[model samples]
Target: MDKAKHFERSQDTAHDQACDPGRRALLTRAAAMSAASAMLGAGGWTALPAWAADTAKPAAAGEAAVRQGVWRDQKRLRDVPWRLRLPAGEKPVALVVFSHGLGGSLDGGTEWAQAWADAGIATLHLQHAGSDRAIWSGGLAAVKAAASAEQLIDRGHDVQFAVEQLLQLQKSGDAAWARVRPDALGMSGHSFGAQTTLAVAGRDFQMRSAPDLSESRFKAFAAFSPSAGHFPGGIKGITRPMLCLTGSLDGNPLGQERDGRYRRAVYDTLPAGAKALLWLEGADHMTFGGGGERGAGFGQRLLGRERDGAPEKLAAHHAAVIKTITTDWWRWRLLEDEGAIARLKAPKGLNADDEWLQG
Candidate 1:
């Protein structure tokens, strides 16, 4: 079958599942059973396995439950929502905080967070006030009001605030976060959010310091389709490992410089050993979730249509490769999962033909 036909079939299947109550219930029950089995298998319901567990369990509690919560960063005051997903237990695992690109929200990073969460890692997805994609669709006035340079600065501060808030939550007896070790933190962002992560890591990009770094914390960083225009200066000071993921055709006139040159400049300048860059061929800025035909603007605009290749299929392939590689990178760097690094640095041919590691 043609790629379009396959996509349509997948969408139809998903729609049917959503509309069919019986299937939904059955799926939910199956998921619950799987979770229970994983917990109880051989180990007798021990709170996660030792490799995955963060802290020692108390006899009274039996095993700690992975906790999920949502809270606002008062320091941001932009009313953006941030969601936290932590493993169920008292053992604090390394934390991975995600920021969204321009016009993206907490929901934008939710799938990525969920992917990591399912892998036994914790994630925090932050929704930037005024700067998410909603502003773009809301009209030019809204976009101008939210996507300003000042707003970007505020957004960067929001990232710092999120880190501080997570640390505070850990200290304040938040059951869902009791096992979170604030010291073991990694930051990631997509597009402008990727720039924000750089700013929080003290990379000398276009962003200004919030003077709250003493309280804010992170150990490593990853960025996807980072906006080069906001390249904060002084990135050389960042000693932590960094990863940059971009597509050959990601340049969008609106935010990221249309020419891949800017991203190339930034990625090339970063110090070598601790940094890696992945380039996906035939992918544009919108390749992640929203650009495909099945996305919000399917009929209105050809978000993922490519002349040389099947855009939708290529985009899906890129997103999957990114999710897999990134999760492995985080596992290796943050959780000290030695086995994950090899998988991350493995040749792209193993997953997708279009994937390439660039210098």
Candidate 2:
């Protein structure tokens, strides 16, 4: 099937869901609250079981522990949902907080999270309600509206609030939170979430909506499919290390920037410090967004698969390269592993067409 045709049919299916009264009633209220909460300030904490997961296992050599929960801020009436993935063992490890793109949920970065966990790093995937998969229950208009500037600002606050909650949880002796090294932290995102990552990194994108939404806690950053054209000021306020991942075919779905090369502006404009760019030959936008063993989620379904007809081996190859490079990044930057730095400089796994640069 043609990619455009498949995406149109998927959008039609999504629009059809808007007609379901029950689904409409539930998600509408939640999305509305998410928008409202973005404007309000912070508040108290309320905990709720967000999802069902496998048994919480101790950190073994090859396994990771998964836990899910919703952390609510009463003052803003914002319900921030999250999923935590920890490496095997009880030792403290570096933590990376992941933000999903528009129409994505906490389940968005499953592949990346699992890889990071298996590599002995902890990950927390955050879902911004107003812009998450909930908006899909509405329609194309709703999805577009959910990506407003207001939600972008709200997402930064959500990251800050979530980190605050994590700190409190650590102080209170939560097992998973306790294993995270607060001093060693990183931030990452995909697409719109990439914009959020930049926001948290102190790139206000020349917007004054929220005086300064930058949080100084994150030590390093990574952005997948980051739009360098969207924001004018390039790497002005971001002094921390950043890794940018984009593919030759990673075009913008919203038509803001048609060519994938435009995405390279993110790496191009950097001021030359601890920054790196990984340009894959055939990977598409959805390729960087999850889709592990469990398969594609809303991102892949909405944007079409990166490996629609290409060789299946190529998809596996891309996945392997991504996981290896990203895990090495977290280790080198967050864990201060010297050997990881060497691997990052040369980057062992890459096809002839793939390019990896470091400065």
Candidate 3:
């Protein structure tokens, strides 16, 4: 199949699952399970037997300070909805702007954002106008149509514009905005949002006459389930530190490249400086989206359970490992913490079969 057509079909499937009420309910249950499994007390979160219990501390004041708003780019006539999650304090912290997948909204990536905030990092979740949940409202045709190259470029613009706006807000002395470390900004996303992250991180989409969409402000990147087919221009200009997170079962559902290992191209094609790849053994695409083992429901429903039931413990372990490694990445790249860098060199909370490679 043509890569573009395959990408479109893949996105269509993503939209279908993301919009499914059953999937949504399952995701919610999975999230609740993740939270419940991690929170043992005020001391710290529950870690896998391989990791210490104090590996992840609770959020400051028991929760993050969330601020929500809509910012309009008058030049492009674009309205970007954003949600900022800050650690519960006035100190300046590293900020990572998160982009959601197709048909996703600012509500996406909350699990990662919350974990980062708890670890004293901030997240700015951006919702692009042309490719958000609004597409699902128009039905499957609109959903499929929303997965366009133009929309992909627009998402990059959304990230740039949102970051620019954040800089301006910081200059304006907004207390919450002031807490963001402008010099330590990072970019991250899941699925199509992962494509957006790479675009801003310097990957090109081979768009004709397209101005450079890569934003130099992002110091590092963390892409979850990034699409290799969406950006055929490959890793020409991307040179910053990046961490690719994917799963062994993280396959393209509606495309020819059904094997999840294909997603590793994003990590494999990079120039190899300050780059890392975390390949979870049993995690699927939605696992990075916060569904854990339940995220593999599509395959489970199709091929029957792996053992007559989901391994709830493994699900929690995946969530814990993601939070642990990603939080450490932010600390290392954004905060320049030597301890974090050391931890990333040999991260804990992984099963024996998981792969953590860096170069």
Q: RMSD to the native, candidate 1?
A: 16.5
For this target, which candidate reaches the highest TM-score against the unseen true structure?
Answer: 2
Q: Which digits, one per residue and each the tens of the lDDT, describe model 1 over residues 31-117?
A: 554565565464321221111112332323332233333444322223546666665455668878877765566565655665676
Give per-residue CA lDDT, model 3, range 1-359, as digits (tens).
43334323222223223222222333353454346545534332221222111122344466887777677654455577787888887789899999887667777788889899889999988888877877656755565566655566568777877887788778777677888888999999887788788778887434333435699988999988875553334564578998999877776543444446768776887886778999988776667774322222333333343422123446788889999999999998988999998998888878998989998
Give the lowest summed-lDDT range of ten residues in model 2: 10-19
TM-scores for every predicted model: 0.68, 0.80, 0.78
Q: List the residue pairs that clash in candidate 2.
A: 59-88, 59-89
Rank list by lDDT: 2, 3, 1
Model 1 CA lDDT for position 252: 48
Model 1, CA-based lDDT: 0.55
What's the candidate order when arranged by decreasing TM-score?
2, 3, 1
Q: Which stretches of candidate 1 lie over 4 Å from their true place?
A: 1-78, 87-91, 205-216, 230-233, 253-261, 289-309, 348-359
Q: Global lDDT of each model?
A: 0.55, 0.70, 0.70
As a whole number from 0 to 100, the lDDT of residue 2 in candidate 1 is 33
CA deviation > 4 Å runs, candidate 3: 1-60, 206-208, 230-233, 291-313
